[model samples]
Target: MKVIVGLGNPGRIFRTTRHNLGFRVIDKFRKRNGLPEFKSSKEFNSLLSRGSFNKEKIIALDPKNLIVIHDDLDLPLGKIRVSKAKGAAGHKGVQSIINKLGTKKFFRFRVGILPQQGKPQGVKKFVLKSFTRKEEKIIKRVVEETVEAVEFSLREGLERAMQDYNK
Candidate 1:
């Protein structure tokens, strides 16, 4: 089974932060696919929704068949990239997952959160801050496109998705 994981801190306050883009994408993907609402999974320490896509069974979390969606500070806002077997590049959340899974071979759908102006002064504070009204509009579009990229990855293949969306 394929497992898609959206990494983010768990809390209402983080719901709209740049750091929670992963959660937002997963939420939208779930709703768009008509999956049931996520339920707490103690064994996995995450919210999970189980279903099938294109006749393939999909569970919420697993290592071998994993696809992680998360925010990337390096790329410009609204940019999307699909990669596999790559290092976390200082993303603590991704590093934590790598430590737990003992490998970096899984797929990743990275949505850029950096503004076009440049990197922010304080990385921690910037990531946790809510997007400005102007930025929110861009984020909305990125989320939609990211969702489509993910669907393309599943329908076609990771390499093809990377070629198409990583432009």
Candidate 2:
């Protein structure tokens, strides 16, 4: 089974914020694959759905393939980085998942949301704030690319995905 999880804070207010990029990516992937809406699961503390792609059993959630999609403050906006068995780098949501799962042996697709440089905003404030019109346009494209990367990872494997999508 391949599990894909997108890490994000729950609630309508956070829906379009930079911190919610993970959720956005999952939504795109689900819609592209013709899957039904994700149902909220208290057990997982996330929205979840199950389906198959290319004959593989897929369980999509907010935590454990557990593939985590989240925003990174280190990289420039719209950049995508895929890693495996890595540390959370101070991301609370990712840390929570790591703690709950008691392992970091899963794929992570990090979408960069940081401005290039010279921005005067704090990380917390920036991530929680809604994206500007320009950022949203970029995010729209990045989400599609992320969906493609996820599919490629599943169809091929993690190594190839990292090589092709990581930047």
Candidate 3:
């Protein structure tokens, strides 16, 4: 079973923000599959949906998968990286997940919000901010890819999905 988690805060204000892009993508993925409705699960701190993808048991899970997603200031904006990211890249959301899951070896479809630089002086504040119109266009594309990527990861194998998408 593969659990795909999208990282973001739990609030309406945080929605549509760059930080919540991960969650947004996941929601898109769930809706695209036309599976069951979401039920609030306190254990995971996010919505939950269970279904199959490409004949594999695909579980759309959030909150818990949050931990395994690393905090990397390395990835460029509009890029989504999937992998077994090592350690917490200084992200509280990922850190919280690590603390909850007690393991780092999990799958996370990382939605990049660009790296902190001179323009965005405060990383925390910037990440929570809304994305620009241009960025949104790219995010939409990436979100669609996220669904495909997760389904690919489940059916083909993580190695193949990683190789294909990481390109």
lDDT of the structure predicted as candidate 1:
0.88
Q: State the C-alpha lDDT per candidate.
A: 0.88, 0.85, 0.68
The per-prediction tally of clashing pairs is 0, 2, 3
Candidate 1 TM-score to native: 0.94
All candidates' TM-scores?
0.94, 0.92, 0.84
Top candidate, metric lDDT? 1
Please, what are the lDDT tens digits per residue for candidate 1 over residues 44-160? 777788987777789844565799999999988888889999999878999988998899999999989999889989999999998889989999999999889888888998788
* Clash total of candidate 2: 2
Candidate 2, residues 3-83, lDDT tens digits: the string is 777888899999999899999999999999988899988887788888888898887533336678898877689999999
Poorly placed runs, candidate 2 (over 4 Å): 60-64, 118-121
Candidate 1, residue 99: the lDDT equals 93
Give the Å error, residue 23, model 2: 0.4
The worst-scoring run of ten residues by lDDT in candidate 2 lies at 58-67
| lDDT for each residue of candidate 3 in 1-167, tens digit (9 for 90 to 100) | 55766677778998888778767877777788776777778877866778866765655444333312222345776676877746667778777777776877666677666743423678888877887888788778877877777767767877677799888
In terms of lDDT, the poorest run of 10 residues in model 3 is: 63-72
Task: Give the TM-score (vs. native) of candidate 3.
Answer: 0.84
